[model samples]
Target: MPLAKDRNTLRRDGVQFSDPVAADTLIFAGALVCLDASGNAVPGATSTTLKARGVAQEQVDNTGGAAGDLSVESRRGVFQFANSTSTDQITRADIGSECYIVDDQTVAKTSATNTRSVAGVIRDVDSNGVWVEI
Candidate 1:
């Protein structure tokens, strides 16, 4: 599946932090995350938790080994996360647009001129998913 007119490319998604932390369990890339009491990366839990810590950047489709090898395997620092958008908020996404944590693993757009803390920002989006600068 190659076209002569097209080539591989990389995009500047985020400015990575100097250090990385391990995921508390199996986590996919682009997952909104929070810090466990031990300061490890854990999957964020629901929109109302207000535990908007950071984003995850690990992706493992299948881990067919014993004892859940995926746990503590994905180590990532403060890097920007990119993934699907909340259907209710996709339309409001634009570059530099402020976004909110709508769920454990997604982001949404905030109402204009409202008072709320911003979770991240809309870096990019398309038919597949969203690119959040978190």
Candidate 2:
């Protein structure tokens, strides 16, 4: 007549131990929270503001879906506009093209116009033109 061995045991604090236990087993003592790069909780970061690193540029998309136009070039990075007090000023030279942050806005060119709106950050300004980050 041999005594039976207890295969599993429970500690006083609610931890469980068993025979032939795994070495790599992870035990969760309590709840865990996740955070973002800013060290803020991910869930609470929904409203977090992202600072723009460079100048602001408005995207101009053609509305008519035409294959060729200045607006198309603007959207494709060929041409970009700088922020102005009333409107976006187009410039070929990089002078006075300091990067600025701006909110999104929509503009109607015309009834048959095929231009759309886009927002992006400025990457660089040169004598040729200003580059935007889409």
Cα error, residue 32 of model 2, in Å, equals: 32
TM-score of 2: 0.19
- Clashing residue pairs in all predictions, respectively, total 2, 8
Best TM-score goes to which candidate? 1
TM-score of each: 0.45, 0.19
Top candidate (lDDT): 1
lDDT of 1 by residue, 9-35 (tens): 888544332112343354466666554
Cα displacement (Å) at residue 33, model 1: 1.7
Residue 24 of model 2: what lDDT?
24
